[model samples]
Target: MNLVENLVVFAHGKESGPWGTKITHLAETARGRGFEVMSPDYSHTHDPRERVAQLLALAPTAKRLVLVGSSMGGYVSAQACATLKPQALFLMAPALYFTGWDEEPQGVPALCSVVHGWHDDIVPMERGLRFAKSNHATLHVLNSDHGLNDQLAALALLFGDFLDQVKTEIL
Candidate 1:
Protein backbone atom coordinates (compact mmCIF):
# COMPACT_ATOMS: atom_id res chain seq x y z
CA MET A 1 0.00 0.00 0.00
CA ASN A 2 1.19 3.52 -0.69
CA LEU A 3 1.79 5.73 2.32
CA VAL A 4 0.14 9.13 2.04
CA GLU A 5 3.05 11.18 3.34
CA ASN A 6 2.47 14.87 2.78
CA LEU A 7 0.74 17.46 4.92
CA VAL A 8 1.56 21.05 5.75
CA VAL A 9 0.04 22.85 8.74
CA PHE A 10 0.67 26.60 8.77
CA ALA A 11 0.09 28.92 11.74
CA HIS A 12 -1.32 32.45 11.68
CA GLY A 13 0.52 35.76 12.18
CA LYS A 14 3.07 35.71 15.04
CA GLU A 15 2.12 32.07 15.66
CA SER A 16 4.81 29.45 15.22
CA GLY A 17 5.69 25.75 15.35
CA PRO A 18 3.21 23.24 16.77
CA TRP A 19 0.99 26.14 17.86
CA GLY A 20 -0.16 23.93 20.78
CA THR A 21 -3.68 24.13 19.35
CA LYS A 22 -6.39 21.93 17.90
CA ILE A 23 -4.58 21.90 14.58
CA THR A 24 -1.86 19.90 16.32
CA HIS A 25 -4.49 17.47 17.49
CA LEU A 26 -5.94 17.41 14.02
CA ALA A 27 -2.48 16.60 12.67
CA GLU A 28 -2.05 13.84 15.22
CA THR A 29 -5.45 12.43 14.28
CA ALA A 30 -4.49 12.46 10.62
CA ARG A 31 -1.33 10.49 11.33
CA GLY A 32 -3.47 7.46 12.10
CA ARG A 33 -4.88 7.90 8.62
CA GLY A 34 -1.38 7.70 7.09
CA PHE A 35 -0.28 11.27 6.73
CA GLU A 36 3.01 13.02 7.54
CA VAL A 37 2.09 16.47 8.73
CA MET A 38 4.50 19.36 9.20
CA SER A 39 3.67 22.77 10.65
CA PRO A 40 5.93 25.35 9.04
CA ASP A 41 7.47 27.77 11.57
CA TYR A 42 6.56 30.96 9.78
CA SER A 43 6.26 34.32 11.49
CA HIS A 44 2.70 34.76 12.69
CA THR A 45 3.00 38.38 13.97
CA HIS A 46 4.50 39.74 10.74
CA ASP A 47 2.69 40.31 7.45
CA PRO A 48 2.74 36.74 6.20
CA ARG A 49 1.39 37.73 2.79
CA GLU A 50 4.83 38.06 1.29
CA ARG A 51 5.53 34.55 2.61
CA VAL A 52 3.00 33.12 0.14
CA ALA A 53 5.25 33.65 -2.85
CA GLN A 54 7.97 31.82 -0.94
CA LEU A 55 5.66 28.83 -0.37
CA LEU A 56 4.58 28.85 -4.02
CA ALA A 57 8.15 28.73 -5.25
CA LEU A 58 8.44 25.27 -3.67
CA ALA A 59 5.03 23.81 -4.57
CA PRO A 60 6.28 21.65 -7.45
CA THR A 61 8.20 19.33 -5.12
CA ALA A 62 5.44 18.46 -2.67
CA LYS A 63 3.91 15.00 -3.21
CA ARG A 64 0.36 15.55 -1.97
CA LEU A 65 0.17 18.89 -0.25
CA VAL A 66 -2.71 19.34 2.14
CA LEU A 67 -2.46 23.05 2.87
CA VAL A 68 -3.87 23.92 6.31
CA GLY A 69 -3.81 27.46 7.67
CA SER A 70 -5.18 29.58 10.47
CA SER A 71 -5.62 33.36 10.28
CA MET A 72 -2.44 34.70 8.72
CA GLY A 73 -1.51 31.17 7.79
CA GLY A 74 -4.81 31.02 5.96
CA TYR A 75 -3.76 34.08 4.02
CA VAL A 76 -0.61 32.17 3.06
CA SER A 77 -2.76 29.23 2.02
CA ALA A 78 -4.63 31.56 -0.33
CA GLN A 79 -1.39 32.10 -2.20
CA ALA A 80 -1.24 28.34 -2.70
CA CYS A 81 -4.86 28.54 -3.83
CA ALA A 82 -3.46 29.33 -7.28
CA THR A 83 -0.09 27.59 -7.17
CA LEU A 84 -0.07 23.86 -6.44
CA LYS A 85 -3.04 21.58 -7.01
CA PRO A 86 -3.49 20.57 -3.38
CA GLN A 87 -5.11 17.29 -2.43
CA ALA A 88 -7.23 19.26 0.02
CA LEU A 89 -7.40 22.84 1.23
CA PHE A 90 -8.19 23.17 4.95
CA LEU A 91 -8.53 26.67 6.31
CA MET A 92 -9.15 27.09 10.02
CA ALA A 93 -9.77 30.69 11.00
CA PRO A 94 -7.97 31.96 7.91
CA ALA A 95 -7.94 35.53 6.65
CA LEU A 96 -9.90 36.24 3.41
CA TYR A 97 -7.58 38.60 1.56
CA PHE A 98 -5.50 35.67 0.18
CA THR A 99 -8.31 35.17 -2.28
CA GLY A 100 -7.59 38.70 -3.51
CA TRP A 101 -5.80 37.68 -6.69
CA ASP A 102 -6.92 39.74 -9.66
CA GLU A 103 -7.59 36.80 -11.99
CA GLU A 104 -10.37 34.32 -11.39
CA PRO A 105 -9.12 30.96 -10.03
CA GLN A 106 -8.17 28.56 -12.78
CA GLY A 107 -9.73 25.47 -11.22
CA VAL A 108 -10.65 24.70 -7.62
CA PRO A 109 -9.79 21.16 -6.62
CA ALA A 110 -12.27 18.96 -4.81
CA LEU A 111 -12.19 18.62 -0.97
CA CYS A 112 -11.79 22.27 0.04
CA SER A 113 -12.90 22.61 3.69
CA VAL A 114 -12.82 25.76 5.79
CA VAL A 115 -13.53 25.89 9.55
CA HIS A 116 -14.33 29.18 11.18
CA GLY A 117 -15.41 30.08 14.69
CA TRP A 118 -18.83 31.77 14.54
CA HIS A 119 -17.82 34.43 17.01
CA ASP A 120 -14.46 35.12 15.40
CA ASP A 121 -13.59 38.73 16.14
CA ILE A 122 -10.46 38.91 13.99
CA VAL A 123 -11.98 37.80 10.70
CA PRO A 124 -15.70 38.06 10.45
CA MET A 125 -17.30 34.73 9.61
CA GLU A 126 -19.66 36.66 7.32
CA ARG A 127 -16.81 37.68 5.03
CA GLY A 128 -15.33 34.19 5.24
CA LEU A 129 -18.64 32.71 4.11
CA ARG A 130 -18.54 34.86 1.00
CA PHE A 131 -14.98 33.79 0.20
CA ALA A 132 -15.89 30.11 0.55
CA LYS A 133 -18.82 30.56 -1.80
CA SER A 134 -16.62 32.20 -4.40
CA ASN A 135 -14.15 29.28 -4.32
CA HIS A 136 -16.77 26.57 -3.79
CA ALA A 137 -15.09 25.69 -0.49
CA THR A 138 -16.91 23.80 2.24
CA LEU A 139 -17.33 25.76 5.48
CA HIS A 140 -17.29 24.19 8.96
CA VAL A 141 -18.17 26.51 11.80
CA LEU A 142 -17.16 26.34 15.45
CA ASN A 143 -19.16 28.07 18.17
CA SER A 144 -16.15 29.62 19.86
CA ASP A 145 -13.81 32.57 19.65
CA HIS A 146 -10.46 33.13 17.88
CA GLY A 147 -8.91 31.41 20.89
CA LEU A 148 -9.61 28.18 19.02
CA ASN A 149 -6.12 28.85 17.77
CA ASP A 150 -5.00 27.08 20.91
CA GLN A 151 -5.10 23.29 21.30
CA LEU A 152 -7.49 23.08 24.20
CA ALA A 153 -10.03 25.29 22.51
CA ALA A 154 -9.45 23.48 19.23
CA LEU A 155 -10.16 20.11 20.87
CA ALA A 156 -13.30 21.58 22.36
CA LEU A 157 -14.18 22.76 18.91
CA LEU A 158 -13.99 19.11 17.82
CA PHE A 159 -11.42 19.83 15.14
CA GLY A 160 -9.92 16.40 15.78
CA ASP A 161 -13.18 14.75 14.75
CA PHE A 162 -13.33 16.93 11.67
CA LEU A 163 -10.23 15.10 10.41
CA ASP A 164 -12.45 12.18 9.59
CA GLN A 165 -14.76 14.44 7.66
CA VAL A 166 -11.78 15.68 5.69
CA LYS A 167 -10.46 12.16 5.18
CA THR A 168 -13.83 10.83 4.06
CA GLU A 169 -13.99 13.52 1.41
CA ILE A 170 -10.44 12.76 0.29
CA LEU A 171 -10.90 9.01 0.09
Candidate 2:
Protein backbone atom coordinates (compact mmCIF):
# COMPACT_ATOMS: atom_id res chain seq x y z
CA MET A 1 0.00 0.00 0.00
CA ASN A 2 1.19 3.48 -0.75
CA LEU A 3 2.01 5.56 2.32
CA VAL A 4 -0.29 8.54 2.95
CA GLU A 5 0.81 11.57 4.94
CA ASN A 6 -2.60 13.22 5.46
CA LEU A 7 -3.78 14.18 8.92
CA VAL A 8 -6.16 11.46 10.14
CA VAL A 9 -8.63 12.52 12.81
CA PHE A 10 -10.60 9.98 14.80
CA ALA A 11 -13.84 10.92 16.54
CA HIS A 12 -14.96 8.64 19.35
CA GLY A 13 -18.54 7.72 20.26
CA LYS A 14 -20.71 9.68 22.66
CA GLU A 15 -19.85 7.60 25.71
CA SER A 16 -16.31 6.97 24.58
CA GLY A 17 -13.17 8.94 25.22
CA PRO A 18 -10.42 9.82 22.79
CA TRP A 19 -8.49 6.77 23.98
CA GLY A 20 -11.31 4.28 23.44
CA THR A 21 -10.41 0.78 22.32
CA LYS A 22 -11.25 1.14 18.61
CA ILE A 23 -9.74 4.60 18.29
CA THR A 24 -6.62 3.59 20.20
CA HIS A 25 -6.13 0.45 18.15
CA LEU A 26 -6.78 2.30 14.90
CA ALA A 27 -4.44 5.12 15.94
CA GLU A 28 -1.66 2.63 16.61
CA THR A 29 -2.37 0.89 13.33
CA ALA A 30 -2.35 4.22 11.47
CA ARG A 31 0.89 5.30 13.08
CA GLY A 32 2.54 1.99 12.19
CA ARG A 33 1.54 2.64 8.58
CA GLY A 34 3.05 6.17 8.58
CA PHE A 35 -0.17 8.14 9.18
CA GLU A 36 -0.55 11.04 11.57
CA VAL A 37 -3.69 10.33 13.63
CA MET A 38 -5.49 12.63 16.03
CA SER A 39 -8.27 11.57 18.40
CA PRO A 40 -9.95 14.54 20.02
CA ASP A 41 -11.69 14.00 23.35
CA TYR A 42 -15.42 14.64 22.86
CA SER A 43 -16.53 12.51 25.79
CA HIS A 44 -18.03 15.62 27.37
CA THR A 45 -21.11 15.81 25.14
CA HIS A 46 -23.71 13.25 24.23
CA ASP A 47 -25.43 15.67 21.86
CA PRO A 48 -24.53 14.86 18.29
CA ARG A 49 -24.75 18.45 17.09
CA GLU A 50 -22.52 19.68 19.88
CA ARG A 51 -20.01 16.97 19.19
CA VAL A 52 -20.14 17.89 15.52
CA ALA A 53 -19.26 21.47 16.36
CA GLN A 54 -16.45 20.33 18.60
CA LEU A 55 -14.98 18.19 15.85
CA LEU A 56 -15.29 20.96 13.27
CA ALA A 57 -13.59 23.40 15.59
CA LEU A 58 -10.64 21.08 16.12
CA ALA A 59 -10.30 20.17 12.43
CA PRO A 60 -7.08 21.30 10.77
CA THR A 61 -7.34 23.86 7.97
CA ALA A 62 -4.09 23.40 6.01
CA LYS A 63 -3.59 19.71 5.29
CA ARG A 64 -5.40 16.85 3.67
CA LEU A 65 -7.71 15.21 6.21
CA VAL A 66 -9.43 11.89 6.72
CA LEU A 67 -12.24 11.74 9.28
CA VAL A 68 -13.08 8.51 11.07
CA GLY A 69 -16.29 8.65 13.03
CA SER A 70 -17.68 5.84 15.22
CA SER A 71 -21.34 5.57 16.39
CA MET A 72 -22.54 8.98 17.48
CA GLY A 73 -19.26 10.28 16.27
CA GLY A 74 -20.28 8.97 12.88
CA TYR A 75 -23.20 11.33 12.83
CA VAL A 76 -20.93 14.11 13.99
CA SER A 77 -18.39 13.31 11.31
CA ALA A 78 -21.04 13.31 8.61
CA GLN A 79 -22.25 16.67 9.78
CA ALA A 80 -18.74 18.04 9.95
CA CYS A 81 -18.01 16.65 6.51
CA ALA A 82 -20.24 19.39 5.10
CA THR A 83 -17.68 21.98 6.09
CA LEU A 84 -14.36 20.18 6.39
CA LYS A 85 -14.76 18.22 3.16
CA PRO A 86 -12.01 15.85 4.19
CA GLN A 87 -10.32 13.66 1.61
CA ALA A 88 -12.17 10.59 2.90
CA LEU A 89 -14.76 9.51 5.47
CA PHE A 90 -14.54 6.26 7.43
CA LEU A 91 -17.57 5.47 9.59
CA MET A 92 -18.11 2.67 12.13
CA ALA A 93 -21.76 1.82 12.89
CA PRO A 94 -22.70 5.38 12.11
CA ALA A 95 -25.79 6.78 13.83
CA LEU A 96 -27.42 8.47 10.87
CA TYR A 97 -30.95 8.46 12.29
CA PHE A 98 -30.55 10.97 15.07
CA THR A 99 -33.68 13.13 15.42
CA GLY A 100 -33.72 16.62 13.91
CA TRP A 101 -30.63 15.82 11.83
CA ASP A 102 -32.38 14.94 8.61
CA GLU A 103 -30.47 15.98 5.56
CA GLU A 104 -28.63 13.78 3.09
CA PRO A 105 -25.02 14.90 3.35
CA GLN A 106 -23.71 17.14 0.60
CA GLY A 107 -20.17 17.62 -0.70
CA VAL A 108 -19.07 14.33 0.80
CA PRO A 109 -15.43 13.29 0.68
CA ALA A 110 -13.97 11.60 -2.36
CA LEU A 111 -14.11 8.20 -0.70
CA CYS A 112 -16.77 7.22 1.86
CA SER A 113 -16.70 3.82 3.57
CA VAL A 114 -19.00 2.70 6.35
CA VAL A 115 -18.56 -0.47 8.40
CA HIS A 116 -21.53 -1.63 10.44
CA GLY A 117 -21.77 -4.63 12.73
CA TRP A 118 -24.48 -7.18 11.97
CA HIS A 119 -25.17 -7.65 15.64
CA ASP A 120 -25.25 -4.02 16.59
CA ASP A 121 -28.37 -3.43 18.70
CA ILE A 122 -27.71 0.23 19.38
CA VAL A 123 -27.84 1.16 15.71
CA PRO A 124 -29.20 -1.70 13.66
CA MET A 125 -27.24 -2.86 10.66
CA GLU A 126 -30.24 -2.21 8.44
CA ARG A 127 -30.20 1.45 9.31
CA GLY A 128 -26.54 1.69 8.50
CA LEU A 129 -27.12 -0.18 5.28
CA ARG A 130 -29.84 2.25 4.27
CA PHE A 131 -27.64 5.19 5.09
CA ALA A 132 -24.74 3.73 3.17
CA LYS A 133 -26.96 3.06 0.21
CA SER A 134 -28.35 6.56 0.27
CA ASN A 135 -24.93 8.11 0.58
CA HIS A 136 -23.40 5.73 -1.95
CA ALA A 137 -20.70 4.62 0.47
CA THR A 138 -18.94 1.28 0.49
CA LEU A 139 -20.39 -0.80 3.32
CA HIS A 140 -18.79 -3.61 5.27
CA VAL A 141 -21.07 -5.76 7.40
CA LEU A 142 -18.97 -7.48 10.04
CA ASN A 143 -19.89 -10.09 12.64
CA SER A 144 -19.80 -7.91 15.69
CA ASP A 145 -21.86 -5.69 17.99
CA HIS A 146 -22.39 -1.99 18.55
CA GLY A 147 -18.93 -1.49 20.02
CA LEU A 148 -17.43 -3.80 17.38
CA ASN A 149 -14.87 -5.05 19.94
CA ASP A 150 -14.98 -8.56 18.52
CA GLN A 151 -13.78 -7.44 15.10
CA LEU A 152 -10.72 -5.36 15.82
CA ALA A 153 -8.65 -7.25 13.28
CA ALA A 154 -11.18 -6.61 10.54
CA LEU A 155 -11.51 -2.98 11.51
CA ALA A 156 -7.76 -2.51 11.40
CA LEU A 157 -7.62 -4.05 7.97
CA LEU A 158 -10.43 -1.86 6.73
CA PHE A 159 -8.76 1.25 8.09
CA GLY A 160 -5.53 0.44 6.33
CA ASP A 161 -7.32 -0.31 3.08
CA PHE A 162 -9.18 2.97 3.32
CA LEU A 163 -5.92 4.86 3.75
CA ASP A 164 -4.47 3.15 0.70
CA GLN A 165 -7.58 3.84 -1.36
CA VAL A 166 -7.59 7.49 -0.37
CA LYS A 167 -3.90 7.78 -1.10
CA THR A 168 -4.36 6.14 -4.46
CA GLU A 169 -7.31 8.31 -5.38
CA ILE A 170 -5.68 11.58 -4.33
CA LEU A 171 -2.25 10.92 -5.76
Candidate 3:
Protein backbone atom coordinates (compact mmCIF):
# COMPACT_ATOMS: atom_id res chain seq x y z
CA MET A 1 0.00 0.00 0.00
CA ASN A 2 1.18 3.52 -0.71
CA LEU A 3 2.09 5.46 2.41
CA VAL A 4 0.09 8.63 2.73
CA GLU A 5 1.76 11.81 3.83
CA ASN A 6 0.10 11.76 7.25
CA LEU A 7 0.93 13.44 10.51
CA VAL A 8 -0.21 11.76 13.76
CA VAL A 9 -0.54 13.91 16.85
CA PHE A 10 -1.02 12.44 20.31
CA ALA A 11 -2.62 14.51 23.07
CA HIS A 12 -1.73 13.18 26.50
CA GLY A 13 -4.14 12.82 29.40
CA LYS A 14 -4.45 15.25 32.28
CA GLU A 15 -1.65 14.82 34.85
CA SER A 16 0.29 12.96 32.18
CA GLY A 17 2.79 14.61 29.91
CA PRO A 18 3.56 13.83 26.28
CA TRP A 19 5.98 11.02 27.18
CA GLY A 20 3.57 8.69 28.93
CA THR A 21 3.36 5.01 28.02
CA LYS A 22 0.39 5.40 25.70
CA ILE A 23 1.82 8.37 23.86
CA THR A 24 5.28 6.86 23.58
CA HIS A 25 4.03 3.49 22.44
CA LEU A 26 1.72 4.89 19.83
CA ALA A 27 4.29 7.36 18.62
CA GLU A 28 6.81 4.58 18.14
CA THR A 29 4.26 2.45 16.34
CA ALA A 30 3.29 5.23 14.02
CA ARG A 31 6.92 6.02 13.32
CA GLY A 32 7.73 2.40 12.60
CA ARG A 33 4.87 2.41 10.13
CA GLY A 34 6.53 5.34 8.32
CA PHE A 35 4.21 8.03 9.70
CA GLU A 36 5.41 11.24 11.37
CA VAL A 37 4.19 11.65 14.97
CA MET A 38 3.92 14.50 17.42
CA SER A 39 3.09 14.20 21.12
CA PRO A 40 2.89 17.76 22.39
CA ASP A 41 3.61 18.50 26.03
CA TYR A 42 0.70 20.46 27.48
CA SER A 43 1.82 20.07 31.10
CA HIS A 44 1.94 23.83 31.48
CA THR A 45 -1.80 24.32 31.15
CA HIS A 46 -4.60 22.35 32.71
CA ASP A 47 -7.30 24.59 31.35
CA PRO A 48 -9.12 22.86 28.52
CA ARG A 49 -9.51 26.00 26.47
CA GLU A 50 -5.83 26.77 26.64
CA ARG A 51 -5.03 23.20 25.72
CA VAL A 52 -7.33 23.39 22.72
CA ALA A 53 -5.47 26.42 21.50
CA GLN A 54 -2.10 24.80 22.01
CA LEU A 55 -3.13 21.68 20.15
CA LEU A 56 -4.59 23.61 17.29
CA ALA A 57 -1.42 25.59 16.93
CA LEU A 58 0.58 22.40 16.41
CA ALA A 59 -1.84 20.91 13.88
CA PRO A 60 -0.42 20.72 10.36
CA THR A 61 -2.42 22.24 7.53
CA ALA A 62 -0.44 20.68 4.66
CA LYS A 63 -0.86 16.98 5.38
CA ARG A 64 -3.52 14.46 6.31
CA LEU A 65 -3.87 14.70 10.08
CA VAL A 66 -4.69 11.92 12.52
CA LEU A 67 -5.30 12.89 16.13
CA VAL A 68 -5.07 10.53 19.11
CA GLY A 69 -6.19 12.00 22.42
CA SER A 70 -6.43 10.45 25.87
CA SER A 71 -8.57 11.50 28.86
CA MET A 72 -8.56 15.30 29.14
CA GLY A 73 -6.41 15.43 26.07
CA GLY A 74 -9.24 13.70 24.27
CA TYR A 75 -11.49 16.57 25.20
CA VAL A 76 -8.93 19.00 23.87
CA SER A 77 -8.54 17.06 20.64
CA ALA A 78 -12.27 16.86 20.14
CA GLN A 79 -12.78 20.57 20.58
CA ALA A 80 -9.68 21.58 18.61
CA CYS A 81 -10.41 19.36 15.64
CA ALA A 82 -14.04 20.40 15.34
CA THR A 83 -13.03 22.94 12.72
CA LEU A 84 -9.55 21.62 11.82
CA LYS A 85 -11.16 18.51 10.30
CA PRO A 86 -8.43 15.89 10.47
CA GLN A 87 -8.48 12.57 8.63
CA ALA A 88 -9.40 10.62 11.78
CA LEU A 89 -9.66 11.05 15.55
CA PHE A 90 -8.95 8.32 18.12
CA LEU A 91 -10.16 9.25 21.60
CA MET A 92 -9.37 7.16 24.66
CA ALA A 93 -11.36 7.74 27.85
CA PRO A 94 -12.23 11.28 26.78
CA ALA A 95 -13.43 13.62 29.51
CA LEU A 96 -16.47 15.11 27.85
CA TYR A 97 -18.38 16.73 30.74
CA PHE A 98 -15.51 18.64 32.27
CA THR A 99 -15.86 22.26 33.26
CA GLY A 100 -14.59 25.00 30.88
CA TRP A 101 -15.54 22.82 27.94
CA ASP A 102 -18.75 22.82 25.97
CA GLU A 103 -21.60 21.30 27.94
CA GLU A 104 -22.95 19.67 24.82
CA PRO A 105 -20.37 17.85 22.69
CA GLN A 106 -20.54 18.62 19.00
CA GLY A 107 -19.99 16.18 16.17
CA VAL A 108 -16.52 16.23 14.58
CA PRO A 109 -16.66 16.30 10.79
CA ALA A 110 -14.21 13.44 10.35
CA LEU A 111 -13.96 9.72 10.85
CA CYS A 112 -13.82 9.38 14.62
CA SER A 113 -13.49 6.46 17.03
CA VAL A 114 -13.78 6.51 20.82
CA VAL A 115 -12.11 3.92 23.05
CA HIS A 116 -13.17 3.95 26.68
CA GLY A 117 -12.63 1.61 29.57
CA TRP A 118 -15.82 0.14 30.92
CA HIS A 119 -14.53 0.36 34.50
CA ASP A 120 -13.37 3.93 34.25
CA ASP A 121 -14.20 5.80 37.45
CA ILE A 122 -12.66 9.17 36.68
CA VAL A 123 -14.46 9.92 33.42
CA PRO A 124 -16.88 6.99 33.27
CA MET A 125 -17.79 5.03 30.16
CA GLU A 126 -21.22 6.60 30.00
CA ARG A 127 -19.75 9.93 29.02
CA GLY A 128 -17.82 8.29 26.23
CA LEU A 129 -20.96 6.58 25.03
CA ARG A 130 -22.85 9.84 25.00
CA PHE A 131 -20.05 11.65 23.19
CA ALA A 132 -19.66 8.91 20.62
CA LYS A 133 -23.38 8.80 20.02
CA SER A 134 -23.58 12.53 19.72
CA ASN A 135 -20.70 12.60 17.27
CA HIS A 136 -21.63 9.43 15.33
CA ALA A 137 -18.34 7.74 16.23
CA THR A 138 -17.47 4.12 16.75
CA LEU A 139 -17.14 3.34 20.45
CA HIS A 140 -14.84 0.58 21.73
CA VAL A 141 -15.45 -0.44 25.32
CA LEU A 142 -12.57 -2.19 27.06
CA ASN A 143 -12.15 -4.00 30.39
CA SER A 144 -10.09 -1.46 32.32
CA ASP A 145 -10.26 1.65 34.44
CA HIS A 146 -9.68 5.37 33.91
CA GLY A 147 -5.92 5.16 33.49
CA LEU A 148 -6.22 2.15 31.22
CA ASN A 149 -2.67 1.20 32.22
CA ASP A 150 -3.62 -2.39 32.86
CA GLN A 151 -4.55 -2.82 29.23
CA LEU A 152 -1.67 -1.27 27.30
CA ALA A 153 -1.12 -4.29 25.06
CA ALA A 154 -4.75 -4.40 24.14
CA LEU A 155 -4.89 -0.67 23.61
CA ALA A 156 -1.90 -0.84 21.31
CA LEU A 157 -3.56 -3.58 19.31
CA LEU A 158 -6.77 -1.62 19.03
CA PHE A 159 -4.82 1.45 17.99
CA GLY A 160 -3.04 -0.50 15.33
CA ASP A 161 -6.37 -1.62 14.03
CA PHE A 162 -7.57 1.96 14.01
CA LEU A 163 -4.50 3.04 12.00
CA ASP A 164 -5.15 0.24 9.54
CA GLN A 165 -8.72 1.35 9.13
CA VAL A 166 -7.58 4.88 8.55
CA LYS A 167 -5.09 3.67 5.99
CA THR A 168 -7.89 2.07 4.02
CA GLU A 169 -10.64 4.60 4.45
CA ILE A 170 -8.96 7.98 4.74
CA LEU A 171 -5.42 7.71 3.41
lDDT of 2 by residue, 1-171 (tens): 444357788888878888888999999877776678888888877777898888778755434588888998888888888898888899999888756876666667758999999899898898788878887889999989999988999999999988878767774
The candidate scoring highest on lDDT is 2
For each candidate in turn, the TM-score is 0.74, 0.92, 0.90
Measured with C-alpha atoms, the lDDT of residue 139 in candidate 3 is 92
Against the hidden true structure, what lDDT does model 3 obtain? 0.82
Winner by TM-score: 2
lDDT of 1 by residue, 33-52 (tens): 55677665665336565667
Residue 124's lDDT in candidate 1: 84
Residue pairs of candidate 1 with colliding backbone atoms = 13-44, 13-45, 14-44, 14-45, 15-44, 21-150, 21-151, 22-151
Question: Per-residue lDDT for 144-165 in model 3, tens only?
Answer: 9998888888878887787777
Pairs that collide in candidate 2 are: none
- What TM-score quantifies how close candidate 2 is to the native fold? 0.92
Clashes of each: 8, 0, 0
Which of candidates 2 and 3 is the stronger one according to TM-score?
2
Best of the two (1, 2) by lDDT: 2
